[model samples]
Target: MKLIGSTSSPYVRKVRIVMAEKKLDYRFEAEDVWSEQTQIASSNPLGKVPCLIMEGSEAMFDSRVIVEYLDTLSPVGKLIPQGGRDRAAVKTWEALADGLLDASILARLEATWPSRQANERSQAWIDRQMEKIDLALVAMDKGLGDKPFCSGIHFSLSDIAVGCALGYLDFRFPALDWRARHPALEKLATKLALRQSFTDTLPS
Candidate 1:
């Protein structure tokens, strides 16, 4: 398998961490989707990063889809539950974490994308996205109260997704000071950082 994405993408990092935890091997193809010369559209119609090319040349886009498929490939370290409410809970945590990433990335693009003229940029839109991130953090911290992991006792996909999101914030929006606001998440991130999977995939 070949993973096509930039190191800076949180979604890509999430997939990488999942693969690492599962002890899967794959080639990394770095691509800058933002560049006009990028060939991302050949693999992904949406021109998104983290497109996985399987052995037979089949393609899988979207980090959530890729990670779930990867968990089924090997039982080395099951990240998703087989069935029941536990599966739903883990998926919910993943959605929340991804949503946070969505908001933060949108806010970042609004503020930093060079394609948009200064007058075209909307501070209001950026503020709204930031607000979503803030609310998501509060909910994540509350949901994680006194738990060893986001979903339950075992470290799962929930923690992987949340860790990637927090790592992105640290890489792009450090001034947000999320750690101070949500100490529980900070603790979780600290623990995650110690993992070889998380450490190896840290965004450059």
Candidate 2:
């Protein structure tokens, strides 16, 4: 398998962390979707990164889809639960984390994308996205109150997704000071950082 994505993407990092935890081997093909020379569209019509090309040349897009499929491939370190409320809970945590990333990316593009004219850049839109991120953090903190992991005692996909989201904030929006606001998340991030999977896939 070949994973096509930029090192900077939190979504891509999530998938990479899962693969590493599962002890899976695959080629990493870095692609800058923002560059004019990028051929991302050939694999993902949406032009997104984290597209996985499988053994038979079949392509899979969307980090969530790729990670879910990967969890089924090996039993070394199961991330997602098998069924019922447990599976739904893990997925809900993933959705929250992914939503945070989506807002962060949107706000980042609004504030920094050079293609947009100064007048075209909307500070209001950026602020709105930031609001979503802030709310999500509070929710995460409340949901994770005193737990060893996002999904209770076990290190699961919930932790992977949340860890990647926090890491992305540190990489791109350090001024947000999320660690100070939410110590639980900070603790989680610190613990995750020590894992080889998280360390190896740190956002560049």
Q: Estimate each model's TM-score.
A: 0.98, 0.98
Those runs of model 2 whose alpha carbons end farther than 4 Å from true positions after fitting are none
Record all residue pairs in model 1 with backbone atoms less than 3 Å apart, i.e. clashing: none
Model 2, 9-123: lDDT tens digits are 9999999999999999999999999889999999999999999999988999999999999999999899999999999999999999999999999999999999889899999
Local accuracy of candidate 1 as per-residue lDDT tens digits, 1-204: 999999999999999999999999999999999888999999999999899999999999999999999999998999999999999999999999999999999999999998789999999999999999999999999999989999879999999999999999999998999999898999999999999998888899
Listed per candidate, the RMSD to the true structure in angstroms reads 0.7, 0.7
Task: Provide the overall lDDT of each model, using Cα atoms, as 2-decimal numbers.
Answer: 0.96, 0.95
TM-score of 2: 0.98
Worst 10 residues of 2 by lDDT: 109-118
Positional deviation of 97 in candidate 2, in angstroms?
0.3
